[model samples]
Target: MMNTDDVVIHVKEMLERASRPITEECCIYRVPLLIRQLNQEAYTPKIVSIGPYHHNSLHLQNMERHKVMYLKSFLERTNTSMESWIHYIASKEPLIRHCYSDALQFTPNKLVEIISVDSGFILELFWTSNYGTDDMYLSLPWFATTIFCDLLLLENQLPFFVLHDLFCLSVANFGNNDIPPFILLTFGYFQSLNESICLLIQCHHDLRSLTNFYLCGENKTTHGEEPMATNSSVNKWSEAGIKFAITKAMNTGKDVDILVRDGIMENLLGDSDAAAERTKRLCRNIVLSDFQF
Candidate 1:
């Protein structure tokens, strides 16, 4: 008979081969085992190693402090009683295990990178003590969902629109596609206005003229009522490009409103000066002042 571990490995291999583009759900437990197998040499060190613990003491302490700050903010903002949040945590403990297991599939360094980015946003937004009971209290499960969604985007498995919809639903209802979805989510709650505005401006930079918003028929085509064209154009900015523009703007302390009014993003998004002016006029006239989503 085959060894049990061998059998399990074979089974996982079969399952993986059967599936096209393994999903988050598919790689949940299998990834950790694969990592262990792949890193047997590194992991087989002296069982009672002391260097990592001693050397990384300060780093670990900093991380713990950061987690505490994030938890504090989340509890305060959601007005969740400490006990209630703890209870919710207990309820969703299994899911957390799955997430960690999923994370372990990648190399430790890759895992750290993802966690750092995801947790940084959480800490930045939620690391505070002042929160109201009336505010929406997202549970750890919801937060995990956000993390997974972000991971999908980072991997390019899902598009921005998917994440945009999820954000809208979590924060507010998404209505018709009149105004941009980011704008709707931002304006829905006043407390989040600053963060929302930042995301909206980032999204505006990401937009490539809404290629899907096209008119149908040739001669007497209806304007603005047509579906998106089958083919869409993209004007994606490199990560370095985004960083440079944002850094320059932040250093100048310029208002984003002025940035748009002064036509800064036009060059950044690869629009000619003339195209930028015409597009701005089109946006002013065609965009609904009170469009919801």
Candidate 2:
């Protein structure tokens, strides 16, 4: 639409505004629409809208009020001021924005407001779930389950650095409450979602590594050693004097009732033929990756 000189000027201006290369700071992202469209419900948050992606969805507005309530509690309990937090977060705007994959449209003040409130909510949630009394917003059974599930969706995320910074800032005020380190608290909060949580101690920053450990039940590679993959069935592994640390287990009633916990099969009924029949069908119609799905 322009002449050569105009084109040159546009290119130069664009180069001047180019973003820094992607680094560790970049983690949050929007799911590709191709992937999301296959099962939009699976990717969408049900209760809480975290970060900027689903920030102001009308359906998620209910949680917005709760976020403010949490912020208020966080400020009151620590005797800190939101004004100061907002100002501090404003200074880190560029670093925070870089963490997200998209170019957010919110102005500086709006972005600061969102970051300060969301970060405070998470910090308060971690603290209260660990140290506070039995009575709190999280005590609501349905709300607790739904909100936590929402928090784990890939799109509903904030950079870990922001949460870590807030934790470091306000942790000293927890005052001998016996709160463990921020990472430990975070681990505890999400432990229910991952049975092989012990591996998280070493692989917390690497989702792929953590997922590998989660599915394989052990590290595929150890330091000073070569990469290796091994497979052993649950019954065989258990028979070999190996015990697994599982999140939960259950004994099903008689008549070949299968036991499941959090979508995972925990135990089969003691009837050998019935259990065998069920186990035989476990892989039916499943699209196995070269590795197990």
Candidate 3:
């Protein structure tokens, strides 16, 4: 019904209105609806919420006091004041808000408070995991298993840069150049889960994305290898006279890679139920990503 010139002008207007500056790196994302629909629970946090998306959720409210306690302990240990942390996060409020897919409904003060507490809690948790003494919370069975699982959920994340910044600040306050990087602390905390999987965390935005990258083998090319194609099942490979043997030489704690040579398959599996479940979850998340795109 419209002439070509009229259509061209209309499209130009639409493009101008839609265009905006890409200032924020997408650090937080809503799990694609298609993916969430497939296995909603997989992407949902069960025991804790790390960032604004799930902040103030009723089921997660129980952990709020624990967050405050951790924050207090962190401040005491490092001799850094909370007001300074609040000011730093407040200055970056806009950029931090832009990290999330949805608009944050909290006022500036509330938003800054949320980010400060959450970030501090994460830093403190990692510190305690690596260096604290006889914290009863860490002794709880649920803390080692379920809490670790929640921390890795797609909906449960703080921007990695925020965590990195806070961790650096804390270490500096302690005047400790000997402190290890966040990645090492993270890997140490979760080494019991799956060591191979922890290696994926360095490059991805969040835990869920890291797991997806590992399952998809997206970084294999970095080592001059092609991305792994969907390989035949363990049973199917065995049928072809490929003898599978657990190898301690490559004990990474998860059979994430397969090396087949001379009718033998060296299976480097970790000795943890948590590692096996993590692999299964990675496979599920990959299928969800497939459905999403």
Candidate 4:
């Protein structure tokens, strides 16, 4: 029997060879089979054939509503548990479509649609159970897929989605070292997109601590601290933070558009355009000199 290292190496190698938009058959179905082959301690294969097309066909047929005679017999024969069934179904390539569809089945309209609820979709799509912990393994993939969908479906109002995507990336990197390499690369790709949502949010308003934001979201903003956007000290802190983030983007060869308007930047610098200009020019000179500032 192969060891844990062998299993890991084999999985990594398979992942490397696979192209973008990975297949459910290969990743979800085949990968598990491969792992089970390598290590018996891994999960058991309860059921198979959870591909997108098959699931979509089931949805179109309205099998859930009618509770068909054959379908009952099929379930009884399979003896599949609900949780395991859902997990297996979600491991497929067309998993996102199924997830979104299943989510909408109990919704008001019983139809799949996005972007009609203003920016409320961001909150709904990426809900957190608690404020303190940052275990986002489940949230990340959904966030990424939603952002990609928004880019396609909400082209006109793409800024909000992009900003939300950036927020996810920032929060993911904020307090975690267990992020997968593909997730990191995906974060980098979204950041590089010229009109970044994160920059817009950072520039338009300052970023409060995650805990503080959570509190504010819950209407428990009783901790007397100045607003991120208007407070002078907060503005300065935010500017420095934005500069650092932008600098990091530049170093990584990502295209970054500064979101702070010139007038606002000047206002933040105590109505001193000269000082702000001087600082920017100095930064430019430092860049030209090839010296790390």
Q: On lDDT, who's better, 3 or 4?
A: 3
- Residues 1-293, candidate 4, lDDT per residue (tens digit)? 75899889999999998654443322111223443444332222111111221223432243222223323332333343334423332343143332222122333221211211221222222332111214353246664443333322201121222224333433443465653332233234443232323222222211111101110111222346443331123234345663322222221111122323321221333434344443343233222222121
User: In model 1, what are the clashing residue pairs, if there are any?
Assistant: 212-228
Q: Candidates 1 and 3: which is better by TM-score? A: 3
* lDDT accuracy of residue 219 in candidate 3: 22
Q: Could you give the candidate ranking by TM-score, starting with the highest? A: 2, 3, 1, 4
Candidate 2 Cα misplacement greater than 4 A, ranges: 1-3, 132-138, 174-177, 194-198, 201-213, 216-263, 266-293
* Residue ranges of candidate 4 with Cα displaced over 4 Å: 1-87, 90-103, 106-180, 193-293
Separate clash counts for every candidate: 1, 0, 1, 1
Per-residue alpha-carbon lDDT of candidate 1 for residues 1-293, written as tens digits (9 for 90 to 100): 75899889999999887733334432122223444454333223211111111112342243345345554554443343545434433443333323322233444443333333323223223222122223233334455344323222211111223224333433332244553444343233223223312222333211111111221222332455663331121121122222112211221213233344444442333434444343333233233232211
Please list the C-alpha lDDT of all candidates, in the order they appear.
Answer: 0.32, 0.64, 0.65, 0.29
Cα lDDT tens digits, model 2, 1-293, are 65999889999999999976665667777777766655567678998877888997889898888888888888888777777687778888987887777888888788888888888888788778777645466679888878777777778877676676666667666676675777777766676656733454432232212222344444233455642223334444344443441221211222123223223344535564555455444323334344421
Residue 246 alpha-carbon offset, candidate 2, angstroms: 14
Clashing pairs in 3: 254-270
User: Pick by lDDT: which candidate is best?
Assistant: 3
Candidate 1 deviant stretches above 4 angstroms: 1-21, 24-64, 73-83, 86-293
Task: Residues 1-293, candidate 3: write the lDDT tens digits.
Answer: 75999889999999988734443466677787766776667778877788888887898899898888888888888888887788788888887777777767899889888888888787788787888646697559767577888887777887777777777776788777788988777666666555334245543365444444322222233544553234434444335554443222222233334433322333344443344444455455343222110
Per-prediction TM-score to the true structure, in the order listed: 0.27, 0.69, 0.69, 0.17
lDDT for model 3: 0.65
Span of ten consecutive residues with least summed lDDT in model 1: 46-55
In candidate 4, how many clashes are counted?
Answer: 1
lDDT over C-alpha atoms for residue 116 of model 3: 89
